[model samples]
Target: MTTLFDRFERAFMPNYGVPPVALARGEGTRVWDVDGAEYLDFIGGIAVTSLGHAHPALVEAVSTQVATLAHTSNLFLHEPEVKLAERLLALLEQPGKVFLANSGTEANEAALKLAIKYGKTTGRSYFVAAEMGFHGRTLGSLSLTGKPSIRDQFGPFATDVRFVPYGDADALAKAVDENCAAVFLEPTQGEAGVVPPPDGYFAAAREIATRTGALLVADEIQSAIGRTGHWFAHQADGVVPDLLTLAKGLGGGLPIGAVVGFGAAGTIFAKGDHGSTFGGNPISCAAALAVLDNVDLEHVRAVAERLRTGLEGIAHPLLNGVRGRGLWLAAVLTEDRAAQVQTAAQQAGFLVNAVQPDAIRLAPPLVVTPAEIDTFLAAFPAILTEAHHG
Candidate 1:
């Protein structure tokens, strides 16, 4: 029987190709497809479902907020939006101001705009970024993204943007100069195979930014909101950047993003600089508040650590060591067979993702249990074997 999803796909863009399974409903760490086949969810909607699907707290918060007050334009103030901003500022534990948006890309776009405005005032024109860093899809964010393939099509981009080697502090120091406005980096490169920088790299970057008078921006779209067992991954390094961009799991499942600025950087945009139509709608803010309230930091940390260790125990010739901080783990395989492993795992009633040809990333919901980790570990060897010989 032809499903509604099949009909819907006929008119939608083909950018995502054809989804293998039409997900129907979800609860906690598991989901069922349209035909009602159950599977363990490891991708967690690319780390956006921090509290998992249909979490009662999120559901009730969203339902209540929508019923009470869904949206109020920036022309007026709303309680949920104000409260959510306060909550984020409190969690950051830093004196700062917030500029809310609707997605990570928009948050980065705001950050980029801030950089440009600040640069103009300071007589600086250039910006520096790192290679393999995935910022976002918008033009300004795309300019900062260091992936050649992503940038290739959008040539003649914003000028004076430099790309450097990630985790190479010396190279970064040499790259940023007096004419540079800002330096953007991911605390841990999530899309570039869950690669965490060397110890003290964040401090080194901060020093370089300070020396050059460039604003330091941390893009935590994928690694923030307890995805890596921390409110913000850079907090683990004790380095406070000039600007921080957040999204992904911020709203549990709803769409929301924010750019936080400190001191002078926070006030760069005087007025009429940037604005959004649905940036801080009460509905999204309420959803994000519920996510923050329900995502217990201690529980997330324990589960993430347990799962990280379990992934290291997968025994196979093609298996290499696992690398990541918290639940955001990537299995480094011996060969470029990450795609094969992903397919095998899917066939075995699991949903995993291959961030790169040789790296398999696991970012399950924070609610996943130890028993689920054990199940994954037990099934891992066979998944590897199936991929190796097939």
Candidate 2:
């Protein structure tokens, strides 16, 4: 019999490689493979499924909106788009203009354009981004990304982006001079094994950007929308970015992205600056609205605390520590055995992400229950043991 993976390998692009298992369905914090093997879901679709799979609110919003009205292109206006933009701005508690897109990369691409336009007006042409930080995989965003391994082959990119050491205030200060158009920072470097910057780093970046007359762009693609126990991760530093990019967990699963430009940055874009065909489509916007409506920040914080505490309490020799905030955590291993650990976890019926060779990222849905967390915590030591020995 031809398996689903065989069919997928035949039909799909090879960028993602062949996945280990073919997922059939999911509910809350659990998923089942095509073979009927069940697993506890901790990755949450790389932090995209904010409400878990088949969530009631997400399902209803998507179903209702798709049935009522779906795509209208940018040529027409829709109520869901307006409502979603308003809600995002409201959550920010700032006056801003929102540009919606289909994914985080698109959001970052839009932000890069805004930075370019700002540069045009200010006579500046360069951007400063953190080393080991990730914005997205698209050309513009990938140029801003500091990882040379993933980005080096695809370039020569068009953007003049400078790389600075992440969490180092002095390096950031030195990089953003008068000729710099923007300074892009991720509140927490998500793709770099969920690494966070030193305290006061964002504040210093804001000060530096202001002094140098550059736009401060926060790429909150992975750390926003209650993932970090805040509306946005930059809130932890109490610094308001000139431009903020958001996605991943924004739509609970359906693809959506947004860029919020505050104050002067909001007005930089002129008519016909940039646009997207599927951006802000009613279905995605409605799904995002449902995510905003149902995501409980307080519960998110509590569960995060429990999970963190449980992780920290484990006395395994292979355990190094934990990184990140709220539900977006990475378990640091003493050895570079994250891939082995991930395979062991799968065999033990749990889903986790080997984000790096030495780190396993855990970004479960906000609605994941205490019991579910406890189940993972209980099985984790054995999983580690199996990985260590196997």
lDDT for position 59 in model 2 = 94
Weakest ten-residue segment in model 1 by summed lDDT: 306-315
Q: How far out, in Å, is residue 341 in model 2?
A: 0.8
lDDT by residue (1-390, candidate 2, tens digit) is 999999999999999999998999999889999989999999999999999999998899999999999899999999999999899999999999999999999999999999998898879989999999899999999999999999999999898988988999998888889999999999999889999988888999999999999999999999999999998999889999999999999988999999999987898888899999999999999999999999999999999999999999999988999989999999999999999999999999999999999999999998999999999999999999999999
Error of 2 at 159 (Å): 1.4
Candidate 1 residues 1-390, lDDT tens each?
Answer: 887677868978997777777899999989998778888999999999988889999999999999998877788888898898899889999989999999999999999999999999999999999999999988999999989987879877966789999999999999999999999999999889999999999999999999889999999999998887788999999999999999989988899999999878889998788999899988899899999888877887888777777777667898998998888999999999999999999889889998999999999988888898888888888998998898
- Model 1 clash count equals 0
Q: CA lDDT of 322 in candidate 1?
A: 93
- Alpha carbon lDDT of each predicted model: 0.90, 0.94
lDDT of 1 at 101: 97
